[model samples]
Target chain A: MGTIGDLGEFALIATLTRRLPQGPAVLLGPGDDAAVIGAPDGRVVATTDVLVEGRHFRRDWSGPYDIGRKAAAQNLADVVAMGARPTALLVGFAAPPATDVEWAERLYDGLAHECRAAGASVAGGDVVAAPEVTLAVTALGDLGGAPPLTRAGARPGDAVAVRGRLGFAAAGLALLAAGRDGPAELTEAHRRPRPPYAAGAEARAAGATALLDVSDGLVQDLGHIAAASGVRVDVESAAVPVPAVLGPDGLRHALTGGEDHAFAGTFPAGAVLPPSWTRIGTVTEGTGVRVDGREPPPGAWDHFPT
Target chain B: MGTIGDLGEFALIATLTRRLPQGPAVLLGPGDDAAVIGAPDGRVVATTDVLVEGRHFRRDWSGPYDIGRKAAAQNLADVVAMGARPTALLVGFAAPPATDVEWAERLYDGLAHECRAAGASVAGGDVVAAPEVTLAVTALGDLGGAPPLTRAGARPGDAVAVRGRLGFAAAGLALLAAGRDGPAELTEAHRRPRPPYAAGAEARAAGATALLDVSDGLVQDLGHIAAASGVRVDVESAAVPVPAVLGPDGLRHALTGGEDHAFAGTFPAGAVLPPSWTRIGTVTEGTGVRVDGREPPPGAWDHFPT
Candidate 1:
């Protein structure tokens, strides 16, 4: 098979979803007009993200498989960020006429790989011809009898914490942008993000007041927590953990760069932080996020950066 | 702001989702790590479609608003085809760095327009910078006491029927491709598809045996039904109602042209077809689709035409 135009939309989708594992949760799968997933809890947590070629990733920097992995990972992370267990994923892929079937298969392999890692599966998707490679992934999750942790739940006197690596993806991105091929760790981070999925569940179980995934810069994302929770968040710069492998600039990269996919949460005062997580800041009686008792620079990952 | 690169991802999404009406099903809307929607029925119907610039629509031929409407229409149509009531839509948009913010807003306006038409709402989505404009929309729906209508339910004695216009969109596409400024009706069909939302519910209520949307040509989609349902579908060209507004070649366009987004279904013999739906064919023993007792031409809307 060659380009999507040649394979056509239905055939392309059939080829892509052929090998995916089917589970009971999928009442209806790919060959259908729509996919039916078991929500069970009377509520489904859904989120969508789009990745465009060139802007999101370069074919030269990442292979088709990497792109698929990144697309699934990011969307699945969104479900996890809601303190839900990802159950299914629906993907939409648009690619040019000259694209190869092998490339698409590789991309699906990556998607399947990540979904398996997240204990979910690729349920269904649509394939269409486009001028560039674009991926839209929607993740559906089950809340597992727990109320969703929202940004508005944090209160004053809450202890702020983080789970998983911070700024490693950003460091990897910087390395890639600078054309510096250094360590395998950095390259892997950029190619496939390993978000702290378990931490989201852990935080929910721990009675976290507010929870969020650090996809944007830490300071900026904290500001969202502050704004939504109606409390000020103060991060102690020195206390914020940085990966040893990232060197001195790692902290800054983690704090400012986006796409780390780490989990950040607030717990009631005197609550014991999980051993897997590190204390980064605290919730206080105020509004907005502050770093070391001062306002950090505005606009960390604003889409319309001014 | 010029281009998605200029505004960045976060800011662009913030601007687009701001002030948009979030339906009751959206328990947690945008601004969080992920969105939480009220599934209510313990199952969620999900589908995704991606539209790329140039391949899906030429910017010169379609305004940003038209593109947005088309994108939302196609995905929501899938949910409806499965006998689900569309509840929420998640959009992912990718555009070049120099694109104007106003252009993005216009696209959202178009998306909102279609969502409103379906009695659905745009819940949340992502904005990313890319070299070309790309849209990925995922639609969520409620089945509401009805089992999903899949392609595998057709029986040998079932009657084939269709709701909504056929071939008009394809006729419009042909006119556009030929550079013929035809009637406004044809042009509107190509730019914005109007799928029969209520008809999907009605079909489910009326006990449709098999169902699908006419997106990739009637003959081809019917073939899918035939293959999936283990039955032969014979479509009578004369019975397949062609919209009169499509002019002389309307029947041909309707037969082979795609993107109508009309609901095509199979009902048991003597079953009452829903209002506005016309009988087009009948399900028979065997497999594959035939037109007027003969094998139809193979290349009609085949994405990978031989």
Candidate 2:
């Protein structure tokens, strides 16, 4: 919607979640005051992310529809990062009262498009008046009888691997920030990240020891694994698979850029890597993340940087 | 915190959820990238709400602490209104980088205070930078072996009752807007609502057929019950146990004021009303709501007013 004030809260929500298909996992959907989601596994993995108007995305760079898709994609990626299949999403939207209802409809369409792509549904949500548009998305996932692959599972001799494109979104963001025109694919990738949803399950099934989503660059996210697992990780720059379009800058961007939402994991020394995964590093007996046998500078995107 | 920008996103979250106790139902709490919550009943009741800075609360009028408590309270109240016990809360906070960390800590303190009061814990949350402060809270509740008392279950011959104070918040809001000094309790009630948490479970235990939380005005909320159940509800103003401090004007406030977060329900005709509940109306074989045998006016608060 152009602005949320005009459409009002209830009407916008009604328009947005109207046509979405409800899965069997969702006993109740958006119409009621709350939603009921089934958790047959007796445990549910949940995470929430809030995307703001100017801070998270700008209207000049991305349309309201793209914003909706990006919000759902990032949150769903979090669940996938945990090696869980995303089941449902609950969204909360806040915007001004002077916004158009049509924009909300388009935004919902984009949200549903991404959710369906990931084999999930928008279970329910709430809408409220606000100064600027803010989207809060909570993603729920099913563990599917598999033990959760936490960051603490990695051990020395584990091979580090990654699935999906790295540095694409960050490079695309740089392109957008510099006001330089780029190919439609590059811009589209930056606006809407298509994370590998199936790779998460594959990694877990392939005996992944530790796992995480690369939303805050490779080296930075690896630091999390290092800290949690208390083991050092060494990255082989030559082995890193950089996207064709990124060329030389690809390595640097992949190492330090953020928001790619790619899956990263560590497997046993002799474990056969999944077809979708590319080996990039290995775990060592120590602490922190090292690039090319040296400690890399701490560089990662921080939303609330001091 | 003064401004969130200065505190940084991670630190802000750490400060906010630090004191939160781990509840019996929570297998994990804040700290991990994602939280795992136990769903012992095999089902989880989920609800979400987003509160914007300028639209939902004015910084000038409310401290960061109050805002945090108010945000958590409203969402948890929804779970209680559904005849469930709140188990966990996941929050998403977006704010400017220039904000103070101490203010963010105080806000978290408020959130933790409310969660403790309601016997729940902050499971996890995400913090991001934004142009203004915004909070998105999602509450997960346990049904406690009782079937949900949905709005569609009310039938003719059901007794209508409420289990908490009404109009205090609305009256407080009106007084605040008018700059008329009133009792500190009235003003505080508007800023921070005290919902009847235990009463919800009790209502379900007492065989409440249809139930709703009085987030909106009593007459207006009753209309929703009427429409959902396809039954008419007649409320006797004289029977409403309004606070004596509200006086005659208080009666009008109780009828039309919103945001009390009280539990209202319909029960079988011979069912004994619980000690916490007071009978105020009865269900009839018709549609819509009537006050004192006359059709109630349509001037109640509408979140998405046309």
* DockQ for each model: 0.64, 0.69
Worst 10 residues of 2 chain B by lDDT: B1-10
User: CAPRI band of model 2?
Assistant: medium
CA RMSD of all predictions: 2.0, 1.9
What is the C-alpha lDDT profile of model 2 across B1-306, one tens digit per residue?
365566666666666676667788777667655788887667778899888776667787778788888888888888887777788899887877777777777787788778877888888888887777889999888776666667889999999999888989888887778887577677778788888788877787789998888887899888888988999999999988778777557888888877878878999999887788999999999998889999776657766543
Cα deviation at A299, candidate 1, in Å, is: 7.7
Tell me, by lDDT, which candidate is best.
1
> lDDT for every model?
0.84, 0.82
What are the runs in model 1 whose C-alpha is more than 4 Å off? A1-8, A297-299, A302-306, B1-8, B303-306
State the displacement of the C-alpha of residue B227, model 1, in Å, after optimal TM-score superposition: 0.7
Q: What's model 2's lDDT at B286?
A: 95
lDDT of 1 at A230: 93
